[model samples]
Target chain A: MTDKTSAKVWENVPSPFCGIASDDLRIEVCGSSVRVLANGDAVTVPGFERPVTDTAPRIAGEPASLEDAVRRAAEILKEARLPVFSGFGTDVNDTRAALALIDKVRGIFDQARAAGGVRNLLALADSGWIATTLAEVKNRVEVLLVFGSDVEAAFPRFFERFVWNRETLFGQDPARREVICVGRAPSGDAAVSPDGRRPQVVECDPRHLPELAAALSALARGASLQAETVGGIPVVVLRGIVERLRRSSYSVVTWVAGQLDFAHADLTVQQVCQMVALLNKETRAAVLPLGGQDGDRTASQVCAWLTGYPTRVSFARGFPEYDPYLNDASRLLKDGEADALVWVSSLSPAPPPAAEVPTVVIGRSGMQFDEEPEVYIPVGVPGIDHAGHMYRCDNVVAMPLYALRDCGLTTAAAVLAAIEQSL
Target chain B: MTALSFTLKSPLRQRLDASPLVPDRLLGKSPKEIATLDLQYGNRRIAAADLFDIAGDDAESVRISGSPKLDFAGRGMTRGSLIIDGDAGAYVGMHMKGGRLCVSGSAGLYAACELKGGIVEICGNAGDLLGSALPGNKKGMSEGVVIVRGDAGDRVGDHMRRGSILIEGNAGMYLGARMTAGTIAVRGRIGACAGYAMKRGTLLVYGSPVSIGATFNDCGLHTLGFLPLLLKGYQGLNTCFSETRACRSRVRRLVGDLSVQGKGEILLVA
Candidate 1:
């Protein structure tokens, strides 16, 4: 008797699509599951789906389909001798979410393939000695040098997740690592180390890296010079750097933003490596090469574990073989060398190459290849769509991706397992 | 590049050092001496004969048996088969030109350098910049293919002027930075800035872009002329590229990095 009439009122609440939230325009995102209300009436509908009308804010249409545009993007990157992945669709709605993964992959592929490949992140990860978790970086790593990359732009949460987190490995109390930044412009903005470790910022024009390296090399060997500014660094600061680098037992030299690949990047790395090598003479000196974003380490690890090398592999002979120059996807596409391709996309942002390479999709974005892929499968987003783990740019801390979305999807691991079995 | 073969019987009595400058030092040495030759591993100079029980020598090409882990086995060997069943040590082929160094396993970083022309194949994996120029040098992977069947460490190709780096797996970041001309490809996804400030080169990404530098322009989309033909030979992803009745998407073409007036291009297959 208490709710005989109200029970049916709740029963007829209806699904979001059909039900009216009393506000109609709010439910106009098209594909999103928004609570809907129409003209003082409630309706119930579910399973929102539709064709992409216009990715206006993100991309444009030139009287051509989006697939062609993606292919063209592939061609452009390839001609530029850049690395590209195929996993793009007209789904701008989803791409916004994939920005992080896309940014990571784009940075890594370009950096690794471009001239800046090594100093970008390869050297440190390859050393297998410098990689450390953010917690370790904040709590234990006493000295940290911020090179080219802006952690704010590159990895937004770098400071909060690693340095300033109260419940981190450094405990609830804030204990930060000493920071030193070197760059051509505004190098010290993003992070300066929260702990008493004030960053010694070395600002230089992008071109004067050689002078900087030579000066550092000189100071490293105990040579005294009269120049007040070297590599845009004052002598006083240079001395501090020398002293700090020499004294630190464990330290990481961050190289980002086209350090080695850029014109003077090589000089920068040479200087850093020389310092690390010198420090090795005294104690354990490790340089942490920053891996560009994307699950690059994951891909490298899986591929290396399965094959022998990383990137540009040929399975045409029914056996995997590494061929850097020849098997490079861009070269293969440009020179018409590779007879076929096995495009790999872990829900990265950009689409596959435009060079008509065969492609596959292995991410949870529900994306399909422009060209019908030999195998089209969808995996869940690591942290949101599905739950799994990924390594940070350092390839140090294994961060578990907690599931946030209720997408019924598989993980990269599962897809890899299936692909492996099928192969 | 011409392929040669050599055979070594036993490790040499003294350390056979192949200076990185001379290609003929290791390339011209006889198999009998190469088999027995040895060098200091770290501080202790060991005999090559003791390290690798040599077998199946290909002398004309300087082919050796055992693993690739032998440090400097083919330091600067040109025109040879420096096959290692296992991993190789650092400075494997410092400046090889017109030859092949095939490793069944991984190789230490800085495998090939200042390479004029040659092929360094790793059946397993490789460390940093397998065919790239060393530090304090202008060129990286000048002209050759450094193929790592497995994963390479880092700095696979630091400053490639004209060459290619093909990875079966993913690559470390900053792959083709400042590349004057070359290509760095990964069958899988790549790290960031795969092609940063590239003067003129191609970076083909089968995966997607996790990050796009503020360089590179976005050209209009088109059905690229070369994509389909090349897609035929690939099978890594067991994927195929072509327009079927089910396919209905268009490709985009972007030109210019505008940063350096760079002609570098980046593609994204829709």
Candidate 2:
């Protein structure tokens, strides 16, 4: 650690850990230790304060040099017939490097949070959706309809930063904004208006979201239903919500894809998107699919720009081939189709999945594994040790991460590039 | 003439793109030439001779001793016949314009996807998106006949514009979902949300469905004249629906989904 007098304070620092990319963080960094000085929440504070550990590389739990570790990783991947590059929890540059490496190795690339993002992607692939960004939600949204998501739990400052802002460009009072929660209600009062108005909650089992979404869409299209209640919510109450959405000039429907955990959840997302599309005929409405934490949006955006498709892509056929179900990392590993696993997680200490194949992990410094992998390389956190670009949940803007300390740990991009060079 | 056959030397360690082995693509190639054809096995391209023991010479009729790793077995085949003796991987008959593709064992996801016109018969269970469109495509299986002797996973006829999918076993959730026009008949139980957001289609279920969507309004029971004709169309095929005892004209018709075009009908045999 450096001297206490050498502490450098950083203002307006953007966070790469949070899905929203919260930018107004005030942090103080002394040597390798960092602290969130102001404007920190439960998610961002712990993210910024994670202490660096295990700065050296290890091969089968034995201390090794960086060159040896990368060479070992490459040798293992080179011997495998089918390799899977999973746990893509890194920033943009890192993801690009990993994709390049995977392409060269002719392996499969899948993100850790791909299962959640695929819910939205499957719907988008079936019937495209119109979505909005954080700016639109902050300045233009008059009615916010959330579906089966506890917004505050995932995004701590979502309402505080966007919904309940001080002023808007359209001259609409932020306090007058209407909030409605369907299926799952908010655990906290973040959705409550400054004028002491609680958000209208229509509670029901999350599994029935598909039916409720269909009901709402039907009601919006002026169709009558024979059933008195759909998904345990009365039809009359759903009609009232539909009427409010129709009256509002700008309405935004949002859901955290990870929260909808049931099977075939993409159909529910499609129903919600279809509802938004119908509402757009007479008024302005768009769906906002959240959940970009752990660099999911960053990896997807980078992959799409380089490749025509999102994640679950394979280069085994000498070209980029995409099949969301066929290229699933977990299924491939479970089926013993993959002979090797290359796991990359730099933002958090989340360990890679336990696999029977030869595993190479390039993860956060403190990541612990149930069993020692074949190769392990401790990497630097993007915002903490190295500067990088990370896309927000909205997928419109990529925030620039600033390095707060000169930690000896290297970035994931550097390690992956080294491995590619060895290959 | 004996059909050209490719027998697997061993269980595949990596997925093999068997698309090049289709009849139209390998029509006039010599035995030596066919042996030298490069097949994609994982990251490396290996000769067909390395993985399979090629035999026989009838190019129009081809046979493959399939493994679960054999993918794209009959992709874009315009003519001739291709048969897999064992379980086939994903995209068993993707984009086939014409010809007959048969898989004697279970097939993986997206089987018969985007099939323009063909006869695809799977003797065993089929994975999800049986006759659905490729990712981002608007139409799925525009013209074809798909017969699955065993259960089919979710989204059986998703986005299908025109086709007939006959499943002799149970079907998973979202049967005939978002389909524009098609006829999907399942002889066994169906999962939830059948005919979801369907614009126009007919889903015939001989067994009771687990749950029907709220948007589908029950039209009560009716004696339909077209039911006998529809069942008769499958008479020559090796499907239980072709049996004389199964050709009942009386059924329960439910019209939905009001959420979309609301023209699709689910006929439950009474």
Candidate 3:
């Protein structure tokens, strides 16, 4: 099912489809890292193309394979739910990256289906969803359900922005509002409310999202929850939480940064959505699907503006298009199909080593250079070399760079400008 | 005033010992006025005119002519361009802001160090830290683009806050140490850490990763719409990034730098 090497033409590409570079294979080595990908047979790189060696396995002009990983996405997506964990087991830095990666992997199935190829696909269609900013959260959201996440680890300012502070609207401080945390494990982020009452804990295995939903439902219905207790909390506290949620004028259900996996989290997401819908029946409420590339939201926002979408796109038809699996870097790396690359970034000691293909680069100043590329372009950091803007974790507009570093290079805007001119 | 010119001299080492290169301050000085230096050769003071002949009178833009083997040609230029027609010295355009400087020939090490904002064009090859911050400083070229037709040495943009960087040729290593916000597109194959310690930034590539650390999780692929816009003017990208009209409806996201609180992302084509 991964072999997408049917030599499909670039034009008339359907929606929800990824693309391989066709018709033009001239590659330029940009100033960036080399990554290998392999999955679908859409494009073949005849060699290993590992980053450790120049003579590893490499085929210069082929697109990386992005197939062979949809099934695994079911498991990988499980990682998207632990943003509220206060332990040492977390491996990923940003939960959004994991979700985006899974979505891309899942996208392979959608693309295959679009091409009339048979594959199981997860339905992403959902009902209306509501969301709020971190600022409004302080005033409006008095009841917080820290489900499957660890705020202490994922968000440094979760308390400062969401919980502990006094708000003008909600008229409540941390002690007044109700904070409930439910996860597979305990969370330090779920500390006792400033009023000296310990936050209720329901330590059920996160995988049993259905059970959690049922518990919440039972509490909402004024019935005794089937489960006696969860996360070491008494059933009475569970009832109290539901009561508080019912009585609150405004409320919010927050997500952890990592719960991107659909296996266990899909039900959770639905439940949160459902809870929002249910809550709205009584009062104003919203859900905050927390976790995005911290500042990458800016890139996502700008990219969306440029290509009318976020994250990934292909330009085979002289226009822009998007497909998750077909464009994922990891899948491409496994596929080993990039002929050359223009790796753009500004957050490393040097470039990321990759397949022995020619490449180009755009990033912060003083980047180390390798001899594999045809060209290297040095750009400025957005705020430092050039003043640019970004979106905070909660989608808030963040402050621009306070000062510019001392040297040459412009901003991403210029690089885009140059790329436009080049095309 | 101080107008440095190396129109055609090779005694740069000896002459450089006697200079007071406050050219901007010497805006209204006479020809026979004074060209001094606050340099120390084993703890000794001298004059700048002793090296290459300083020219020009009232021009705000400083010019260093002649094929002089000068070092530190355009170090820390505040608001100007260094047009060197011949081989020059190190720290070219170091800490520059708002101006265009061109070096017609080859250059020494640490070409453009810690450039805050400006445009520096090195027609020839350059040394290390071409567009990076100085040692002990976490900020590199915060703004501006350094176009190097040749290869760069190493340690570029260490701890940059924001900006865009493009290397026309090749780079040594340690590209972006800890960039908070910005985009860097290398026109050529580069060294390691392309997106290492990135708090938030985008690193695109045409080739595969030579070596990837655990810091960046391998999220799958997703099509981004910004490619064509980024590939617009470059010839190579014209072919590699022809409009496909395909977009990644879903993308895999990797969260790393577990060592610190970071939502920085590094995306690659899957």
Candidate 4:
């Protein structure tokens, strides 16, 4: 090991990529590049290094001053009769500032992850369910029931950081932890525990999760099923799983609502919630619905705090009105309800929406546009350009985004605030 | 207690967050100090005196007159009273711990949200999620009273834990949704899904209900003796509830949310 005291290191750097928001990463800075020392993987490599690329502000495809670009963007928005603000892939303060602009422009607000966001809030409004924090799951969770989703595919570092963790403060052995994946095969042929043990996965159709949940809930309630197999899984297998759940100290059912394939998929989510509730009566159980992609939760939280609603809210009536179905970004763009668009994506260098309208794009420096927008402003990434806050997937807590370097770039919040002032 | 009043010179050009200008911050301060207080206008920060003309010095009672796009009127206030003579913006009396907040004109979304104690009264229409929890927060309005004399928007008292929300006019859908413990009484017609997903709460509707959620099970109509006692509690609160004593007639009580706990109940007065 290179002299421990001689190398420059940054400790406790929180990553904003995944929903886990693990803050135990230790990074070693070598010029413009960084080498993640502790708890670093393929996900963290790009998550930490990509934001350091050069970016600039432009007006009509030509490089321009930041002030000039903001003024032009404001003028465009002021002239629009209907505007849609989407692709909110940034931090909390950025969303708050963008909301101000949305209000001023009488625009409809949404995020790239609006599909899952709508389902999550609708499920919450339809029925309240119990949830726990990440710490609780990492330390005390004995059984994890993943439904309809390959959690490892979405959250690459989840098992390493939480499930198969080696240094659990609680005495629960990681080797003995039970991880059951239903409706999808575990990505890695086999899921190995910290102490080299493989867990069983049930093969079933993802669409049948709702039925499976109902059947399992009934089984947990001591009801007998007439059918020998339900949802293509043998009743005996389900019974064995239920026995394991009851024998465990604490169990958590997890799923990514975004990955559900059915339309109005919140119904399936309701069933999952029901299963957790039913299991709680017999043993300690809770649901962990994870989907914090592209700062969706952060945007919802900011919008809820200001307008008392989640996304799909329109300030066009001079008063905020929320309609999850009517004001959906996809519907608005398809039906021509929104005549203009402002896309903000500072965390990831994703392309802007392909709507046939005047679009103003605010993205990371290295982002490439298929066709140039009316105006483009490249802002600093949240964890690199400025310190900010983001909510974890569990929605129980928010983690801080640290600024490791000053790349002389303005944040999306600053750009939107400037635009708001101009308007 | 003297009265301190702020009269807007003109309508606001942008949304102004007046969360920092609570009674506690202005109580012991001089006129100059009060004038120099900070307020967030859209993204710009401005002094208090720049937006409105100030008058009086009462700390216990504060009245803001005129129609400025002001929000967060009494945010996090623990004591005293705040009065808005004209239309108030969103989040009025948000997370307020104590004291009284009264709005004479229409109040915006999230009015009296997540209130822990004290009272909030709006004479005009109120917007969505009144007495509801902030997004991601599980509990809202753990303890308090909210009275809206006019119509109310959707999801009123959503996810409320413990409190009482009284609406004299019609209310939209999902009233008292997912509430663990609370009392929601609507004197006018209520929209669909009243007491939806409610684990333990009492929802009293005095008018014709559109529909209740599928999870609720009707327990049949009955003349409850406690109706008079419940009405007596709101006697002097508002004139709208003055006739609550007449609700001693038979009411249909439904218990439900069978999908979850199924312990909550909704009582419809005939």
Best by lDDT: 2
- Classify candidate 4 by CAPRI docking class: incorrect
Write the residue-wise lDDT of candidate 3 on B104-213 in tens digits: 77665556666766677776776655565543355666776666666655545545565555555666554554456555555456775444444565544433454433
Q: Return the TM-score for each candidate structure.
A: 0.45, 0.97, 0.40, 0.61
Give per-residue CA lDDT, model 3, range A76-174, as digits (tens). 222212110000000111112222332332221111011110000111122335667776877767787776666555454366445776555635655
Fraction of the real A/B interface contacts present in each candidate? 0.00, 0.63, 0.00, 0.00
Could you list the CA RMSD of all candidates, in the order they appear?
21.3, 1.8, 27.5, 11.2
lDDT of model 2 at residue B236?
78
After the best TM-score superposition of candidate 1, give how far the Cα of residue A355 lies from its true spot, in angstroms.
2.1
Worst 10 residues of 4 chain A by lDDT: A1-10
Candidate 2's docking class is medium
Which prediction has more favorable TM-score, 3 or 4? 4
lDDT of 2 by residue, A74-148 (tens): 999888788999997789989999999998988999988898898899899888898999999999999999998
lDDT of 2 by residue, B186-251 (tens): 999998888988889899998963578888888999988887888898777778888878786588
Determine the TM-score of chain B of model 2.
0.97
Candidate chain B TM-scores, in order: 0.71, 0.97, 0.72, 0.95
Off by over 4 Å in 3: A1-125, A184-197, A209-240, A259-267, A347-359, A365-378, A396-404, B1-270
Better DockQ candidate (1, 2): 2
Best by DockQ: 2
Which sections of candidate 1 miss by over 4 Å?
Answer: A1-132, A141-143, A165-178, A186-189, A192-199, A225-229, A232-236, A247-251, A257-270, A280-285, A316-319, A323-326, A339-341, A358-379, A408-423, B1-270
